[model samples]
Target chain A: MSNKAKHWEKTKGQMIITMILWFFFGYVIFMFGENINSASFLGYPLAYYMCAQGSIIAFVVILFWSAGRQEKIDEEFGFTEKEDD
Target chain B: MFKGKFIDNLPKIYGTYTGGFLVFIILMAIAESAGMTKETIGILFVAFTVCIYAFIGWLSRTVQVDAYYVAGRQVPTVFNGMATAADWMSGASFVAMAGGIYFGGYTYMAFLVGWTGGYILVSSLLAPYLRKFGCYTVPDFIGTRYGGNFARFCAVCVLTLASFTYVTAQINATGTIAARALQIPFELGVWVGLISILLCSMLGGMRAVTWTQVAQYIVLIIAYLIPIFWISNKGGYGLFPHLMLGEEVARLGELEAQFGLVKNSAAAVKEAGVPGGLKSISLPHSEVPAGGMAAWKFISLALCMMVGTASLPHILMRYFTTPSVKAARKSVCWSLFFIALLYTSAPMLATLSKLSLMDPTLPTGIIGKEISAVMAIDWVSAWTAQKQAFIADFNGDGILQLNEWFMRGDVVVLSTPEIAGLPYVISGLVAAGGMAAAMSTADGLILAIANALSHDIYFKIIDPKADVRKRLIVARSLLVVIGAFGAYIASMRITGILGAVAWAFDFAMSGLFFPLVLGVWWKRATRQGAIAGMITGLGSGTAYLIYVYPKFMGNPAWLGIDHLRFGIIGASVCLIVMVVVSLMTPAPDSATQKMIDEVRIPSGKTILGKQH
Candidate 1:
């Protein structure tokens, strides 16, 4: 495979892993969080708490981390362009 | 702050806008104290705020193609984030989403999760690449990636359908707010909304939409937070509603048990003279779904929503306005942060509103009272007068049973201030905020549809040599026509706001999701594959929705999915079709492959990737 294709493969793998992380935090926790409802967090039901606040916090973290990491990936791969602005 | 031109002016512009808003609020207060009726105050408030937006649109009017098409491609990350958040939160989200949570309970988290998770998809998979592609519209990317007008035309078709469906709902929402605030007929109110939408979008295109949306975001977030904060304080949660909602949940559980007692008592039923009324009484508060099927429905709905959020045309267009690919990625994070401010607060607002309505101290509760006494509370009487809520002692017991109290969920958020006994102006402010949410979204959707027509069809296909002035004329005129059509559909009131929005999301996801995602990621994806995938996906989704869904709603689960979750089936079909078609067909030629590689890079000086 060409170098572009190899880079594509690596980035694709990373993207999939990132997506799986989101799926776990968004879907898995949402589906099974109720199993932990007996537990409480900071005066709130754990399941409801995760659904309302925790999941969003997790999403923000994942997005920022992925964005920061992708910049590094691009730079390492020599794909970064000079800032046009 | 940095010393760049736009950056240097940002703080001054914000200051002026903020000062203007504060002065308007002070004037409103004086009018309220000078004995203006609440209805008059509400109408004046909406009118003043909407006119301000229209005036901003007039001020930012642009004839240049670049400014009209993508706001000159210079929006900073933070302001673009604000604009995007305003554009994303529609009337359904601002008004009905919390109401859905109030009525549907834990299951409604599908909306919150789906929408926010979709942003993850956008930030990771779509936004940066699309920004690097540096095109004007989604169709532009598709056309260039696939190297054909056919693919672009197909994209335009899907964009129009999806955006039209979404815009109609927004117009409907705008009409609802106007009708309630002005005490006018719903039909007339829709015309009022259409006029404001046209005024904002027709003159300046996306440039006007972006700046006005920033203003709308500020108004909307403030309007949303105020009543919720008031409720949180009143509920003894101090200011942190998220942390303190567990106690409210526990208290609500106790109230549910008390209502359940009334539901099961045969003596009470016979005394009330309404047999089988217990079920309706207990049904509204029973939010938890039983067994595995409920979980399946939740996951499917959430999945549909997440994918749908990523696929919507108007939203994708917002990313094109950012200054750089990195700014595009950063804007997604900022959009999520701003949107979370409302989403996290919505459930808390719903819970508090439910508690307030059921509080035994209020006349709204299920207590024994004379009819006159029960009707004495101003908010209760106000809702009943509007026919939004009703109380009837069906059993002749002279006591309101839980079943006897019925309210349309749409009014829950709108009536929260009155229900909580806050001042009338707060309700007026909420109305203004709702209008802002509706108008901001409407402005974006109308421009999306019109841009597809003018840029994709007129300039690119019909008149490739059309001057910038000619293109601007076409875009502006199309905005007027499309705005009127959307308003007419909304006035017809074919569906509720949330239902229409859900359908729009599903439609957009089914048709556009696979093609748009593959276009950027897979270099081998051919024009034929995209066209085939979009057609089959859209065709099958629409066919199922039109032919099978109504019949299936009452039947057992079809493959563990419901009508609302049909986007999953559509998306699955598109993925299979696209992969098969692309593998069977020849890959895109060398030039297209080169362009795809260029899009993959975060920042590159590429000939094809210049801003249009």
Candidate 2:
């Protein structure tokens, strides 16, 4: 495959991982939140903290990690944007 | 000392801006004690902040298309993130999300999840490619990618519909906040807020909107945080509230048990608002589906909002303003960081605010108090006079039931400072912050639609050769017309801000999500397929919304998907349709296929656009 194909594959593979994480935190945890609420964390229901606070914190980490990793991939494939306009 | 570029100056400028704003707030607090009326302080807070935005707008005004449309494609990553955060957080997020949590409980967390999660999709699948595509507007991408005016026109239609719905909600919020502060009629407040937004954005287009939004973000974050920190300290949560919010939630849960306050039940009549005139009379956090439907509702709304975030024109437009595609991707991280500062605190704010109100130890506590005495309390009487809180002696027992003392969700944050017995200046400050949130979002939404109308519909389709001056003039004129139309709808009190925001997301998600995503990722997507996809997704989604809505058909939702989540059905149908049609139809030309391949790469000139 061409470099273009490789770049696209690397990006798509990263995205698939992202979507899985997004699904797990965004839906799976919340879907079973009732059961999760049976457990407590830091004096609050576990599911509630996950949804209201922990999940948002996770989203930030996910985006930043993906961005750093993608930048590395861009460097590997020489796809980084030129500095000068 | 600072001879560098704008990016180099941002921290210093923003630091000074923050310090100066703090000094001004302190001055106003002093003035408040010096017999400056509450109304005067409120007016000063709004007028002063708006003037600052207007100054920034004036400084940034331009006739160049790139500057007007994409801020000369030079916004730094961090500032773009700040601006995007401001633009994304409308009146709904500032004034209503905590209120939504106060009312909706766990299910309401969907807004936090969906709104933030959508950025994941933006970073991974959309923003980078769209930036590389190098279009001025979202419809520009559609028009060029699909190779026709028809596809662009359809995209424009969806963009306007979605954005217009959202703009109305912002206007509603602006009007309410303004009306209370300025002692003006609600109808008049709509125009006051609308005019401030216009003054901020009408002069400079995206350039002005971007800078002014950055400034607004500072004011809003400052405004949002002060009350939280104050209440946190007073409530014994100390300076770092998040560490102790779970304990507070446990306290609130205990209070709920003590008061028999179950979450998500249909509110009593008085609290629910007027009798069927606008469902808002008691617009709880959302149509949180009950029982087995709860999980589906959360997932569905979260999915709808996430897709909608990835697809919104105003949001996507922010990415185009960044200097590079990498900047576009990185900005999402910053955007989430800035936004998360507020979102993470929201549930805590909701918990702490609710705790203060329901603690039964406070003088304002009313759940079990006699209705007559609760009605006589200063804050209660004040809010009652404003009709924001209604205390009814429903049972003739003359006591306030948990359900009897009805409060508008919009009032939660607005009333928190008062409930906490802080200085009225904090209320004025919060008002300014809420206005900043509403105005910033309105500026972006109105500009998004106007850009679509003028850039896509007028220049692209009507007269491709219109001059720069002519194009800018046309865009500004359209902004006035659209702003006025949005204000008129808002004045009618159509629905609650949060509900309309949900509708806007659903509309955007239904019509634009699949087509835009496919245009970037799928080489086989044809013009015909794109057009078919937009129409079907939008059409089916809107039909379901109206069908499931109580005011309309009142039909039962399929698979527990409420009207608010109609985007799910629409997007699914659209994805299947677009793929099928692409396979059946003749393939797009080789150039188009190559363009698709090029969009995925990040290091070159935009295929469909000109570099400055």
| Overall lDDT per candidate, in order of appearance | 0.81, 0.86
lDDT of 2 by residue, B507-580 (tens): 99889998998898888999989999999999999999989999899998789888788899888888888889
- Native contact fraction, candidates in order: 0.53, 0.73
- Per-candidate TM-score, chain A: 0.88, 0.94
Q: Local error of candidate 1 at B486, Å?
A: 0.6
Highest-scoring model, lDDT? 2
Q: What is the C-alpha lDDT profile of model 2 across A1-85, one tens digit per residue?
A: 9998998899889889988998898889887766778688776688888877888999999999999999998999998888775
Candidate 1 C-alpha error for residue B357, in Å = 1.0
Pairs in clash, predicted candidate 2? B272-B281, B272-B282, B273-B281
Per-residue lDDT tens digits of candidate 1, residues B1-612? 445685558767877787777677678778888898998889887998899999989988998888898998888888888899999999988998788877666777778888888999998889888888878998988888887899899889988988898999999989989988988999999999989888887788899999899989888888899889987786565677877677777777677767552433556545644422112234333234566777777788889999999999899999999877888898998888888889888888888888776668654453434556767877778777776777657676777666666566667789888777777777888899899999999999999999999999998889998887888889998999999999988888787777678888888998899899999878789989999888888887876676546544355447776667777777788888988999999989999888888788776653344434
TM-score of each: 0.93, 0.96
Judge the docking of candidate 2 as incorrect, acceptable, medium or high: medium
Model 1 off-target regions past 4 Å?
Answer: A1-10, B1-7, B261-288, B361-372, B551-557, B606-612
